[model samples]
Target: MTLNPNLRLRRAARIIVLDPEGRALMFRYDVPGRPPFWVTAGGECEPGESFDAAARRELLEETGIIADPGEEIARLTPEFITVEGEPVQADERFYLVRVSEARIDTSRHTALEQRLMTQHRWFTRAELADWPEAVFPESIVTMIEQQERAR
Candidate 1:
């Protein structure tokens, strides 16, 4: 699909949060009348915000998990339409972060998040492999596998 040039590119940062057990934490978005999907916790960077800073901020804002976001592990530019019906060209960087717990505090979610995001779950690599819902990157399984192989 051709992306609308009227929409400027958005710089975003995402955290691949792994719990102590190595399960990845993801947020489930359920928009009524549309198919549900899962996405990592993160969002667009604020003005003048560095990618690392944005990653850390988004992680806490979206999941209420305050933890150090490690180095960037992957990057991608994906074009898609937003929930608001606006086309988005996102330059997203994924960072690896480890958390001690999977429990999330949703008090910090933005209005949009509170409305669209329904749940959060910790999934093992095996679980992710068989996940029925749509995944954002669509390459999440391969990314995890590559990370595992690198280590």
Candidate 2:
């Protein structure tokens, strides 16, 4: 699909938050009248913000977590339509973080997220591989495997 000429390129920072048991946290977005999908917790970097800084801020904003974002693990650029009907070419950098639990506080979600996000869950790699619903970063299983091998 052609990107919207009116929108600028988007640089997003995403966090792959895992628990001690290695299950990854994902946000379940269920837009009104639309099918649901799981996504990582993060957003586009604002002006004057570094990718790492934006990742940290978004992680807290989306999940109320305040852990170090650590290092960038993978980068992918994908083109997709936004919830607002805008076509976005997103340059996304994914960071890996291990959290203690899967619980999240949604009070910090922005107006947009608050409207779209329905729930959150921690998925084991095997579960993710077998998930019947759609998940962003389609190669999540491979990414987790790489992170595991590195540890």
Candidate 3:
């Protein structure tokens, strides 16, 4: 499914927080309105919040994780079809962050209605590559590849 060229999509940012072992912290959601996919911790920039601040806030909220914001790694505005087959548009910015610590605390996430993810796990780059179809975003794969090449 492709997005309508005339549709006006809003912009958002997603941060890929990596551990020392090259594992990335991601959020999994199976809500009714959104896709059942695991994505990097991020969201739309709130008023007066810089992109990095938004990223940090998303990380802390969704996964109970915190990281020092890193460089902007990659960007994409991939279009996706909603569960109802309607074209949903999004402009996404991807950032790299090095995490200092992460712990799961359900109390931190009151906004998410999804039951599939109330905790976080570490996933190696290879593990992410081998994820089942439609489970994760393609931008994650790109970020892993870039990290590999930089090593």
In what order do the candidates fall by lDDT, top score first? Answer: 2, 1, 3
Most accurate candidate by TM-score: 2
Residue pairs of candidate 3 with colliding backbone atoms:
none
Report clash pairs, candidate 1. Answer: none
lDDT of 1 by residue, 1-151 (tens): 3444777888999888888898988889988777999988898899999999999999889888887888888998888777777678888899888777767788999899899998888988888878898877777777777777888
User: Candidate 2 on 14-89: residue-level lDDT in tens?
Assistant: 9999988999999888876667889988999999899999999999999889988999999987887777777888
TM-score-based ranking:
2, 1, 3
RMSD, each candidate, Å?
A: 2.3, 2.5, 3.8
Q: For every model shown, what is its TM-score relative to the native structure? A: 0.89, 0.91, 0.73
Displacement of the residue 63 alpha carbon in candidate 2, Å? 1.0
- Local distance difference test, each candidate: 0.84, 0.87, 0.66
- Candidate 3 residue-wise lDDT at 24: 87
Model 1 C-alpha RMSD vs. true structure (Å) is: 2.3
The clash tally of candidate 1 reads 0
Q: Who wins the lDDT comparison?
A: 2
**Residues 101-141, model 3: lDDT tens digits:** 54444457654434546445677877788877344566586
Score candidate 1 by TM-score against the native: 0.89
